[model samples]
Target: MLIFTSVTWLDLCLASAAVYLVKQLSGKKNPAPYPPGPPGWPLVGNIADIPHNKAWLTLAKWGKKYGDILHVKVPGRHIIVLNSVKAAMELLDKKSSIYSDRPVFAMGGELVGWKDGLAFLSYGDRFRYYRKNIHRVIGSRTAVNVYEPSEEIEVRRFLKRVFAQPEQLDAHIRHTAGAIILRISYGYEVKDNNDPFVDLVGRAMHQFSQANDPSAFMVNIMPWLANVPEWFPGAGFKSLAREWRQTLKETVDAPYKFAKDQIGAGIAPMSYISNLLKGRTLSAEEDHMVKWSALSLYAGGADTTVSTIYSIFLAMTLYPDVQKKAQAEIDAVVGTDRLPSFADRDSLPYIEALVKESLRWNVVAPTGIVHCVSEDDIYDGYYIPKGSMIMPNIWSMLNDPQTYANPSQFNPERFLDNDGRGPEREPRTISFGFGRRICPGMSTHRSIHLADASIWISAVMSLAVFDISKIVENGVEQTPEVDFSSGLVRRTLSHPEPFKCSIKPRSAKAIELIQQDVNY
Candidate 1:
């Protein structure tokens, strides 16, 4: 091959520039009709307008100004926000295949080494592989029941901790959730709050949430900045990413290695990891996937479960009437002689409604793992381009006045019909997400998962065992505030601010029942 002259190199550069200009210019010609949104400024588009905190609320307000489905453009990218159930169903659910992909989460995924996670994976055969494995392992009806005893054991342990040290309820919940997830995913037991595994995983998760926050990393917006040296000015995020990567790697590998060691020693408990490892001889890549997926299960389940459980407790404290009503229903069915179990779910209609309402009242995953479009599509005369981010405003949908009357008020009766048989319209608190990207592991100790009812059993049992009320201080009752955090996952924003709650035994029989259940 002959070396190119300066003139030749210049000509080549001109040709490339010409093609790029043409491509950019062509896109502007006959541009598809994008959905109505707040008018954005030149160059930056809506990037400046996007609210870092409480984005869902701002999007909902935008929905009222601009129709139910609205669009906002950041430089070189597009975002579609769906604020109504009808609109979300029409696109995210009805046309799922084309709208089920995930956006490129540069900061949260690649930089932090979370790309192996199923939640952040793009739509493809690999995504399908992870999804298939997850569903096979935990999403199936049979698989869910297989893990019920582990869930039940962890939950009873949590109840005992709450009964013993209710002041440390938060730590107890965090410990219980971590322990249950570790046991189910890797056959690993979390010994205490200071367990190395819990600490490592917890740090990774905390960093993950921070990295995912829109304002946390600038490299997410300008990806090229990631290539810059870590020591460069304004490149501190890269250093942070490096630290996160180390923690995350340990989070993904440590428990998996422990499980493998147990299996090799012939003392491994049956678990998602142990079973999968024993079933087949996977390639190196497949093995990596399994490890990451197992870690994801632990990471995904723990904090979300904590949030929902906290919300349940907050709701009970705030609305004693609802608590009394659910307790009455539980007592009527299960009797005060024993703690309510999954067997009583069929009879406790009010408790079921209470569960649904808690999910709907203050959703956990508000925007719910934003979906991306795989191809260009048009809905109601508006164009949604391929690769556009789709945010289903679950918070808005949950609080829709049309679907839920007095939605802000904590009311379980909304789930019941006039006859009070079952749910009139199931709460679309799809906090787990939607379409194929939906969270396969949705079960928690206080909420029902798609396939598992063990956690639901725990929630009812807690309700049956304790009467949560405002703490009586000197002669006055101080009610805990129903304040919530504004993050990707909604949580009781209290920063260990000792919320006053009098967690009293419903009766002597109830305490006896709790002891009996705890012993089992």
Candidate 2:
């Protein structure tokens, strides 16, 4: 009986091999040929070369070495990086129907329940519905209306915070942006940066960022390991995934619950969650959907906005000439008597240029959410296979020497015409992403940045005055040029390790205006 059983097992294994071979032979050939990339090792592919931080920058360097489009193999995954605007437009825009899907990740999808998150959801009916709803709420027209009051209040608050404690400008800027989004989404104002909601959101973002780190899970490379039981001793990732899931659930559902309770008591303020909850019964699936949407707003809006503001500050500190030019424009247009507003945006051309340049200098969403091909497509004689992951390398495009001279320089003039008008309706960098996945918060983001930047430069006469250049260790100046954190969303540029700077009122008039506006 033992001999018979051994022979049967061997026969089954042989049959399975034969079936797999037959299936491979019967499968259709990849219609379009993939682009060339660095020679990858078997099984692991190029995974070894990819760093946890600044993966996009590394990929962009590889793109320059291997031409505009490069194909990379990461275990079971096939990734295509479109390093040029033309290729990105061809794949992610022109052929969006076959290229709008997102790649499936075991942890992000099944474990964390991100299958329904608009940023990660596949291209399907549900994704379409979510996108449509997001558009209706935060799209262009609505974004303008939604931004008006928030921008006014937050810019004033930010100025007051800076005037009070210039040293805490970084934290204050972060809080101001977070408060705006929190109020918009949940009708909950973050009165203090230490508010539980703020801490919870910050912790949740850190958890998500860590979880999404390339090396966070081996399952991203070999997904079969995801099925390992959490009770198993070696299942380290299983515990981490569970913790991440819990964090996400709390961060997402807490605000939702708060809104629901407020609505039940007929005391809910007009906010995104309140609007979503009105006249809608919460089915299990609907509840999950609503929570994900609200969480997206919170997470997406807060980090990116704060990062951009930091970048703006860094740019001003690094390029004093540019800062002077922008301040001159602000002084000429809005003057220092009062803070700048959205209505003054058109008049302050240089400030708009500064805003655009800051976004292009170091995009917050560098690689953006990965794009998956829904079907086989051909572009520029290269075959892009169905199910392949496509990345529009925004870093490469923003730094393309062909488009912008001295690409690394933080010069806002690149985005302005000789006459000081903004770049015409041509393509800018893909900071907001591409095609259907373009950020729904684009208008709101732009408006906020414009208004805030204008107010900042107009209110503060000299960023040089607060310059920490005098306080330095080892002969290094504390400047924005030296401070930058790595990763898709880098921190401030050229940030001095630790330095002190002073903030004094540019004028008594500016101070009085800020105080009155603080109460406004």
Best by TM-score: 1
Candidate 2 — which residues are off by over 4 angstroms? 1-29, 279-284, 419-429, 443-478, 487-503, 517-520
lDDT of 1 by residue, 1-50 (tens): 11112224344335545655776788564246899999986555687787
TM-score of 1: 0.89
- Worst lDDT window (10 residues) for model 1? 488-497
Q: How many backbone clashes does candidate 2 have?
A: 9
lDDT of 2: 0.66
Each prediction's total of clashing residue pairs, residues at least 3 apart in sequence or on different chains, is 0, 9
> Clashing residue pairs in candidate 1, if any?
none
